[model samples]
Target: MLALSAVHETLGKILEPPTLHTAVIFTPAGQLVSWQSNPLCAKDDVHLVIGLSGDAWQGAREKGYGMVHHNHLGKILVVPVEDVERKPGEDKPPLMLLALNATDEMEWADMQVKGKALGAALTKSWSKHREHLTVPKPPQSSVAILTGSKRVTTR
Candidate 1:
């Protein structure tokens, strides 16, 4: 799991623009990881935005536009956080960064640059932290059966 504080700090820096209302880190499947907003946006709203972004992202790819594509929403910018350390054909999904309310060309440009930096930072953190991820092993035990008055092990 990525550090929430670190993610928020990176997002906070990107949300420097007055028009930029919110920034979210989420998967292409709409799982929100982290977010930072200027006026305290709701989690539900963030989820909705991410969902729309995911659809737009998919549409863009389907149209052969590539990962980086501007959606019809106009104000939202979805940037893909690609993991450089990941091997080819790896099943790991890349994270997406979405910024809300980039009204003009300059703001859009600003978001693109800052969003890329945030993506790179997040990818690095995710790659580093993933090394420490561990799965819990199942417990090993002998099966017990009660016949009449005694317990018998059936391992």
Candidate 2:
């Protein structure tokens, strides 16, 4: 499991003014894994990150940029915590989404640098504590499979 204090310290070292209104790590499915935020930050803000992350991820993959979007609330930057260069036969690492509620003061250059730094830190953390992080179980869904004239249900 990721320590809240570690997250705060990492963000503090990277962002301008070294403050975090909201910092969260979530799964691809928008499951909140760990977070730290200021008093002004609402838990509901996580929903916003979830929304931003999904879109930004797609946009970034398409455009090949680091900082995806910036709005009135803050900026959204996501980096893959996984090491994509794994050895053959090794399972691919899970990506940890890093979303920050950073204000405009953090310019594009600064934000890109911070995003890389944060990604490095998180990648290390992910490797060290891979088993500790929560792995959301896949939702059980009944799938219908046809066998000749019969229908079978499988989860």
Candidate 3:
């Protein structure tokens, strides 16, 4: 599993000055996996941003924008943490990065460089701890097959 401190340190190195109010790693379904916040940040604000940002990212993809590697939405920055080994046309990744700025001071150029670094770190973490991080689904029920009036259950 990725350490919370490591995530905090990486987020800290992304932007300076006004500083980031909060940063979070979440699932495609909008479940928060991990987060870090500055002393001045409110937990409610962080949760709200994560929920909204997850929706924004999903909307972008559904609207034919394709996978948005990074988005600069005023005071918010959303970046997808993609698997480097993913093949074309595969399902969308399960994790994303969302950062809330103290103000609308984040520059696109700066964010590109820093966001990639943060995303790469997250990707590495994902690859290393994929089994542990993934949510386990219940086994599927057997399907019934009818052949020549005989019914058989098959997995």
Candidate 4:
């Protein structure tokens, strides 16, 4: 399994400083697999919820974006990180690593385009390490029907 720390380090090396805040990987079932971000959000489960939301994941896939770490279904979501300030007179929360300034909207758009290339690179990398990950396959029923079956079992 890919470790969260490794994901973070890899992203940090690839993305520019302004866009290198955090990266998260989630299972198709919406479970958080690995994530690296500001300590505040890292420990906050709410961020995980946002990362694993079905809408976000599906949207990325529909847009043809995501890390193809293996042949399995997965997505890479890039969104504006919310800036949080602690209560009055308190210290500021740790800034997210990939958070970009509002004025960098154009840069963010560029990054999204670049993200597509990154996805392709990931696909190639994963293909080279295919033995390490399970590649999901389409259901057999969807591909062919068993017509010569002697018995049918329904549970």
**At residue 34, what lDDT does model 1 achieve?**
81
Stretches of model 4 off by over 4 angstroms after superposition:
1-6, 15-20, 38-40, 45-53, 66-108, 128-132, 135-155
The total of clashing pairs for model 3 equals 0
User: Residues 1-155, candidate 3, lDDT per residue (tens digit)?
Assistant: 57777776776655455544556677665677666665556667667767666766667743321122224323555677767676767774545555444455555456555555777777876765655666655368867668998998888
| Model 2: how far residue 23 lies from native, Å | 2.3
Candidate 4: residue 129 lDDT (0-100): 43
Q: What clash pairs does model 4 have?
A: 20-97, 20-98, 21-97, 21-98
Q: How close to the true structure is residue 87 of candidate 4, measured as C-alpha lDDT? A: 40
Model 1 off-target regions past 4 Å? 62-74, 86-92, 95-101, 104-106, 129-155
Q: Candidate 1, TM-score vs. the true structure?
A: 0.63
> Which of candidates 1 and 3 is the stronger one according to TM-score?
3
Q: How much does each candidate deviate from the true structure in C-alpha RMSD?
A: 10.4, 6.8, 9.1, 16.2
lDDT of 4: 0.39
Error of 1 at 139 (Å): 24
lDDT of 1 by residue, 1-155 (tens): 55679778878877755567678877555667788888776777777678766766676643311222335333676766766675766655454545444444445567667666776777776655543432333346766678999989876
Alpha-carbon shift of residue 119 in model 1 (angstroms): 0.6
User: On a 0 to 1 TM-score scale, where does candidate 4 land against the true structure?
Assistant: 0.45
